[model samples]
Target chain A: MATLTELTPKLAPMEPVPFVVRSIRDELSDTFTLELDPPDGVFEFLPGQFTMLYVFGIGEVPISVSGDPAQPSTLVQTIRGVGAVTYALRQVRPGDVVGVRGPFGTEWPLAEADGHDIVFVAGGIGLAPLRPAIYSVLANRQRYGKVVLLYGARSPSDMLFTQELLEWGGRYDVDVLITVDNADRQWRGAVGVVTKLVRRAPFDPHDTVAMVCGPEVMMRFSAQELEGRGVPQHRIHLSMERNMKCGIGLCGHCQFGGRFVCWQGPVFSYDELAPLLLVKEV
Target chain B: MPETLVLDRSGLASILSELRARDYLLVGPTIQQEAIGYGPIDSLDDLPQGWTNVQSPGASHLERRDDERLFGYVVGPHSWKKYLMPNEVVIWRGERTDTGFETVPPEPAPAYALFGVRPCEVAAIAVQDAVFMPTDRVYRERREAAFIVAVNCTQAGANCFCTSMGTGPAVGEDAVFDIAFTEVDRNGTLAYLVEAGSDDGAAVLQTVVGAEPASDADLAMLESVLQEAAASVTKTMDTDGIHDLMLANLRNGYWEDVGGRCLACTNCTMVCPTCFCNTVEDTMTLDGTTAERTRKWDSCFSIDFSYIHGGPLRMTPEARYRQWLTHKLATWFDQYGTSGCVGCGRCITWCPVGIDLTAEVAALRRVDARQGLSVPLPEVMA
Candidate 1:
């Protein structure tokens, strides 16, 4: 996270410099990924940080960076064209220009969890924010212990990073377990909530750093199951998403209890957020 | 380290002229739509002469005072945030052309001399300073350029609790007020004991006609006036362990009761001095050639404030009201390292339903002993 108050942005706070879309790839029916040529040079950002993407005259929304942290040349963002702003952003052609602000918020503990077993739990489209951390772990695969990824989607077709999931499953060093809420006869993997696979996943709970992201209810259940496995609350981090504007923390839209999810979080340990997550509508 | 200057019967007029001479757009208290609103002030006559306000839960009335004091009334519905953060402003404007786009940069903040600012409002400005400091662009510019002239309160409104909040009826020596004044009644005529907090204010005072250095007795009278003002505030919000109190009772039953009465009309947030939540609006021409991203005041009470992929997180009035109250009383400290409220009574007075937060906090404390997700219970309102 941006803990230092003095490291302000280089550009004018609200002003946006435009960037051209280099490529577009459709991940799912409603979700797509946009890779943009950097406005200045390279759009450097930490794993799990987000940017406020603006569609010229349409609007802006906070989208997490889904690209590799090491690749600073191209900025990659996943959009679930759910709102007017995201829908407008998806309408952009390859050469079209758009606005970008920030690379704000805290990063995943990929560096801190280097010596520990890493378990990544993702639900539905939650993999977008966790992708950067996965890439980081793969780049420095020798530095980590056991690596496991437990992903659950609404259906097989709704899953994200399908190609990468298969590639990781083929590796002997990485454990990739996939599940779905409902499936047809064509499917062979487990068909249940992701929380059920927490017990069967191969990792020492005491020596693992768990990073989870998904729907709130799924995250809550996954966290509970993880805690039940004897993994400490502080060792488990959840990537949170909340409504926010002016990602610098001026606008109060992203306030989750006392924590501004835009700045202080986006990645908060279960120990810091257990009390808040338990309450409904908090 | 500046001494108080005494301005005679014509001193008020000279002060107004001096401010106008500096090319500052003077914004002060005035009568607008049956309320005291901060608007343009051309002369001393523009002030609400003898008007006093009576504010209570869900109700407020204007009454004529017997004395002919210039600033007899306390703060009304208007706050200084309207000028600094603004209700709406085009922060970024862009025009699309054939090859690329042209841009019209945001305009600079205007030079302003804010007259008749109260002590509570001053504290509120400080709270906002910590919030917008990180992105210090428009807010910092407007706040830095605008001169502040704080006036010590002669009386407190019924809903006011500045004393309890420790953001006073008196502007202290440590305050950032450019010039502070205490209105006094000398025999039958009205006079002012002026103290300059900044060098610019002292320089302006030196050029004023008929201005003389105030004596020790005059300074003592100013103390007495502030002491009386401090004793007059009736309301209170017991901030003792407020942070944990609200956090522990997130699902407190009393919140449901407050939700039942809250209209969610958002009058309270609009009138609040330190409520700095806002939303950005994008407007473009029919041809889509030009676009402007304007920031407007927003309330957490609004459903869209929490809208995400599935739907709005805070769906019910109870949830929205809980978020707003908990944010104002508790979570604000964690976010900005300071209390969000300044204890100004605008939220209480301007609320159409009169859902007082002071009463709500007290009620929350009473019901917290048996905390649960229980149905709405009888209110413990005082």
Candidate 2:
């Protein structure tokens, strides 16, 4: 039998763009933000989606973009020093360089929130991603009504964006509330899990577009709190984070049941994530 | 239109030499190390002249045959994917520059000729065709331009389950291959039964061999060999309702047992010609001026393969093992419209733990058959 030589199609590029770290801001003890300048038009990323930062000798890791997508000059990533790549990235300061691939994955659907009340609920470093949604909504302040932000952290020191939280709390059009797991001597406002803070907030469940990002346990409980307040399952969105190797759907690591989180979604409504949540170890 | 011609056994070497003279790469089967494998070939002498394979339950091996026949081996460890997808293909290389970064796509292999290709491999090639040649990628460009020389199996191996997979024994001359050949032992001397499946194949055959209409006896012998091949296969898979069975058995405790023993070494995928998962790596120079993004073959079994924002979605080996097996055997049908297994049995031969897909299917079948029975005391105790 004769062999057939069929020409393959054009391949898609999954390469990482190189970026140099301009500075590493020690935002908190466990959290830091890396400011990077990738060529001229480098920082083209939405808030909820993440970039796979490559550190030579230590491998690459996915970190969410903490900066606004509107700014296309400098790429900024807020990272937790839990792994090797993040740890190496934390060591880099002004002048050290790293590689960046992506801004990969589908971003949160901000267009879907038009003419709807924006409710942002963030816990600990979960605020890193929520900051963009907050900034975007505040930038176009007149498009929606009753902007309620409910934030909770492990402790007062672990709270990110404290100044921004206070400033937003004093805004006439914004309602911001902050809580912690347990208040230390320096803490004053409230001490409880993030879910407890939701009970004290003003919410018209039908009119709200609630977005939550945090640890799985915190997000799960926060969504439950929203549900208890009669929020529609489709209206409450959560940003999901899984260990990702290739931001492309090819790698099986980020699969949540039948769905590839990288390709299908990183931000899904509770109704969408509920079935997958039933799969244990998912 | 492509022409058809027949060649004698003596003409094989001349044709090979002619192609070699033209500088066209010729690859065919040979006895490589332990088993029959595909590699670059110079003459008919390198072909597996009298070898056959046996596969069953959980093993596969090659054996010598009494007849001095060429291209006699059953499915081997190597498939056409070895050439289609090299062990490593540099998709793109980026270099640090004064401007920032530049990327260069990896060059694919040039056009070549493949000989002694089997029908099951043709089916496997079709599967790869769906994978790499469609939607996106230059995989199709390389495939469409290459030459195919296919051979029909005169004898089927004991482990030959292509019939069960609905792939072969013999393939139609009207599709897939360019040239198809059937070997015949004509009163102790070997003669080839040939047909052109494409115009290019006819053109090549016209330059290489003598023309003769295949005899009735030769046709009958070819049919009988095909019938014998169909009967020789000892392994069979009941694909009728396997997908539902696998989906139902997801939480059946058997997975946990398999997972506990699984080393997660990913040998099953690496050896499987159809598995196409890949991982990308980016690197910078010592000066940090340039960088390149490289894609490498990745296995689903690795812990890093499933990293999410916080950690791995499938943390336990049980979950990962379940994902691989279920996706290959069950969900692949939904995704690719065909069973992933080609009945080649490469995974069984390459597995460190000897985890056989056929055996796994049989076990699941047995378990399904006994669903209404009372639970065994020993099973309950365990």
Candidate 3:
């Protein structure tokens, strides 16, 4: 049990490296996207992984990587100014410094879904975490069978990456369906919950892998609708959200049942989380 | 390899002095305020001599024993976690600079010799080792530098259930103790049969002046003392199928009944040696030029412990209590490959409302049996 007598002589796991804000783009009324420049000119991360962004005098919060994996040097994070740390982060301008740690947690299993049809279901800011996965699928377009994306937002103004969604919809090999809970007279897209779009999306249920990320209730309903259609529970994946203090597995805040969301996953198969999800306050 | 020697009760001071000579801080049980707790002990006078503890649900009292014995009590309110894992630790500090912020890591921990550690506490330390060693550098550093001098219990407290937990009364075979001692009553005199389990322990034993090799009769007396201690345990918990039983009863109504009485004060988790959950707090200087990130002990009973973007996951006492117990007894096995409870009875004794986990588990099983509901085991995944 006494494996090592001395502490590992290295940087502490919680220590954050310095990163400069190269650019900040406001996506919505309260949300902004910041592109960071790492000290080494490189910051690599998977599609579903998140980074702990720390403001100088404020605290840290976990935000998912929203950029393309191929262009790993320019780290992009989309954050909603909901809390103190995030609000502080939203105020940062270009040339300011911020602390960055990780790109931690499991990635969306895009490789495993290689020869299968892929359906992406994202609600609100949930699309930011799934953007990298969409990039991976599009870059290797020939490797997959069919690609479909169903996105829902609170209102037409709340939708993210509108231009990219339009371009992807114009692609001959892809299908994109956009929906909103409330829309104005100018909005011509569907108006309903994301689950309604799940029924309209075209793909072989048996051969398709569904990746859903949204509010807990939205994901739960979307997973149910997918399962009701012929997709196996194990083939469905969902990215879970929990209060995370430590990006590593040390802090117990992100624990969901026996597994830590920071370690075992922020992304887990529907079958794996079904039992725990059924239990209230779990 | 194992070696046994005999030392009179008077020679215990030599062991303390030898450890201090090696620059290892000695921590042992002592009388503080009104109860016993582990603290710095420089000499034999600091020990809780002739003291015995009486423990019950929600109550604990210390009284004088008939004879003057240093290791007379089974355990105290404090476990070894305070010294090893610690209550609060500053992980790193960052200072604002001209270009960017520069962070400074915390210093390494000092060497420590935990004196008078009971067998159950040793097992508790081992349990924590499995949980933290792989992922926690701070805990690993402190634990690696610790020298454990375990004491095999000669008596069991009223609330103790280590005999049922399979962790106490006698030190486990695989326990990593530098030195172990078992107090035996030889006729009218008291002696400690010292066993050295490591080279460091043997080096300290050589410095003692009045120690001698133990005879066969001495070993027999030690065996009888341990056997008596094991038989004296008044509380017992049935661990057979406990993991499956608790998992099946996640939605059990008994949790609400227990939660109605529970104050959610977090006493049980605070005293529990194996509960290693913590929360991090960032404190900034008034000038806003520097900030420090510190980790402190946290409990699942706190609603904020499970808070996320919207609100807390555990909003009710029933949910919090269920989470604590299920994680301690059932889910811990799945996560760490061992039971989290060491059965030291601190949780039962220190709980404000006297909530006994053992009794609750029994009630859960009885209700399931009466209902005759067949529960299938949950699918295990990493």
Question: Every model's DockQ, to 2 decimals?
Answer: 0.47, 0.32, 0.50
Q: Which residue pairs come into collision in candidate 1?
A: A1-A106, B58-B354
**Cα deviation of B346, candidate 2, in Å:** 2.3
Q: Which candidate leads in DockQ?
A: 3
Order the candidates by lDDT, highest first. 3, 1, 2
- Flag the better candidate by lDDT, 2 or 3: 3
The recovered share of true contacts, given per candidate in order, is: 0.54, 0.38, 0.52
lDDT per residue (tens digit) for residues B260-314 in model 3: 8889999998899888889878888999899988879999999899988888888
Query: Candidate 1 residues A65-166, lDDT tens each?
Result: 999989999999988989889888878889888888888899999877989999999998899999999999999999999999999999999999899999
Q: Pick the candidate with the highest lDDT.
A: 3
Give lDDT per model, in order. 0.86, 0.72, 0.87
Count of clashing pairs, candidate 2: 48
Ranking by DockQ: 3, 1, 2
Least lDDT summed over 10 consecutive residues: which range in candidate 2 chain B?
B373-382
Flag clash pairs in model 3.
none
